[model samples]
Target: MQAAADQGVEAIRILGVKLINPGDFFELLLRFLFNLIVTVVIIRFLYYPHSRRKDYFFIYMIFSVVVFLVCYSLASVSLQLGFALGLFAIFGILRYRTDTIPIKEMTYLFLMVGISVINSLTDKSVSYAELLFTNLVIIAVTWYLEKIWMQKKEDFMDIRYEKIELILPERRADLIQDIKKRTGLNVYRVSIDRINFMRDTAKIRIFYRQDSNVGPISKEAPKQTPPVDS
Candidate 1:
């Protein structure tokens, strides 16, 4: 009975080890940690500082994690590279179908997906050092472009204006000055989008150099003057 009990205990230990697969689990944990650190650096530190879009911040983080986990699991099953590329294309198209994402946002999304794939699917043939270097390169390039290279970005917003008089071609100078004073934005140019003679209102788009000090403003026009007609 003592020998039989010992054998049972040993069998249970073997079963637990088989179920746990400690080696693969450790590898997954290691890769996931690296992937997460790289993603947060890109999205939280690099992108958020410039764009300041909370919605995209959440989307990018979640997208990166989900993509990483999915790719890693599929890779364990020996999924082909083509399958991963196909998955990337599908997600990209689905994102676009929901809304027309801006070029910059799309680019970031691409980076997140690509980074997830690279980190998760890389085989034993690729050393961990090589993987780390590749991620660093991507992060370095993104940081350079976002912080050092592109300085002086132009932003625009559409506004419904009650002052149809100022929208006239002859009053363009006065119009720009008035908008600047009202909105406190450094308005450089204005374009009349539409005129509503019946309501005495005009839709206008204003362009200005985005000031870092002023921070990110919403796409919706500020209500500095009269209430805009709904």
Candidate 2:
């Protein structure tokens, strides 16, 4: 009778221990789901539109999803540090031959990875409300910077200027003045290509500022003198 009672107490304690462990299957599923949802949301909403190449956006989405799943699963198993370092090393090698990514896109990738790292290191039972809030803040700030500040300031100001080539012969001073007036930029350097002695014509080329505006100059027809008839 006493032995039976002791066995019952031991059984209850075993069940209690199982309940309190953080490695339970349900808890692992919940953490993975939370991380997966936020990561996908960030990639789709914040990172996709800024990318110039549609193919890159698709690749980014797929890569982020896989990374999130692997990182979350590793976290559940409490092997986060080892996994993170290995993944970092792998990416470092991958970056060597990879095409350049825009700074904005790189920033988004960093944020996504940073969030995954934080999620992996956090306790399983901790409320995910704060995690969700942090993701929202990151996405909002990145979106605002990319759309409102960077694009507006750099759009027209960073024009690619080139040297000008002139195929018509005209007065040098008049041509220079006309170019300045038309482009709103001072010519930095001017090179005279050739002079035709037969036609008394000249070809000139110029190097000018990129942001300077250039357009065709309109000419007014010369007025005819009235005939001085007897």
Candidate 3:
């Protein structure tokens, strides 16, 4: 009867206060810790072996917690679908910042957001068991994709490239040769970020195989080499 009475009280509720539901609050606590554990496992075991960024480690933990809270708070509203969509819409704007988000980190962000939405929302159609299973499935899939299935990805670099002559269509081979000589990267493709004919400079995004030595942002300037004979 006590359990039934409590359910009755919660069901008829029109509005929710953040701390009103102790059960929900505890669930949030558990969800936050679970997410943290899963995220750490992914980052520490899978991603860290590749990128090795400590800053991103901190950011992912904090970001996941904040997203979970937002979802939990909005779950009680009548228009939850709209609210959830609105939440993700805000993340889209994060891309336009000066430093673009990498595809990997962006993917993790989406995963965290999705987990948050799933963990927070209470629905009759989806029971607690289903939610638990859903979270576990996501973790399992991520582990497999990151660790087992995909062994490699193409490496990329953002360079302040300044070889306008080599970048021309007629000198494609020369460009590759020159870049390889200077940076020692097996550059497979180049993308133009900016062009300044006046300054004889063009910002280049270089894509290469994973074996390439160049990290995403290599501070050391490429050594100037003798111009490759055309």
If scored against the real structure, what TM-score would every candidate get?
0.64, 0.51, 0.58
On TM-score, the candidate that comes out on top is: 1
Candidates by TM-score, descending order: 1, 3, 2
The ten-residue window of minimal lDDT in model 2 covers 154-163
- What tens digits encode model 3's per-residue C-alpha lDDT throughout 1-230? 98886676666645553324657657778766776676677667766776677787777767777877777766677867787787788888876754777888888777767776666665668876777787778878887887666554476777777778888877888887888789876787887778898999888888876542235545457799889998
Q: How far is candidate 1 from the true structure (C-alpha RMSD, Å)?
A: 7.5
lDDT by candidate, in order shown: 0.88, 0.59, 0.73
What order do you get sorting by lDDT, best first?
Answer: 1, 3, 2
Please provide, for model 1 over 160-218, each residue's C-alpha lDDT reduced to its tens digit, 9 standing for 90 to 100.
Answer: 99988988899999999999999998899999999999999999999988765466587
Query: What TM-score number comes out for model 3?
Result: 0.58
Worst 10 residues of 1 by lDDT: 13-22
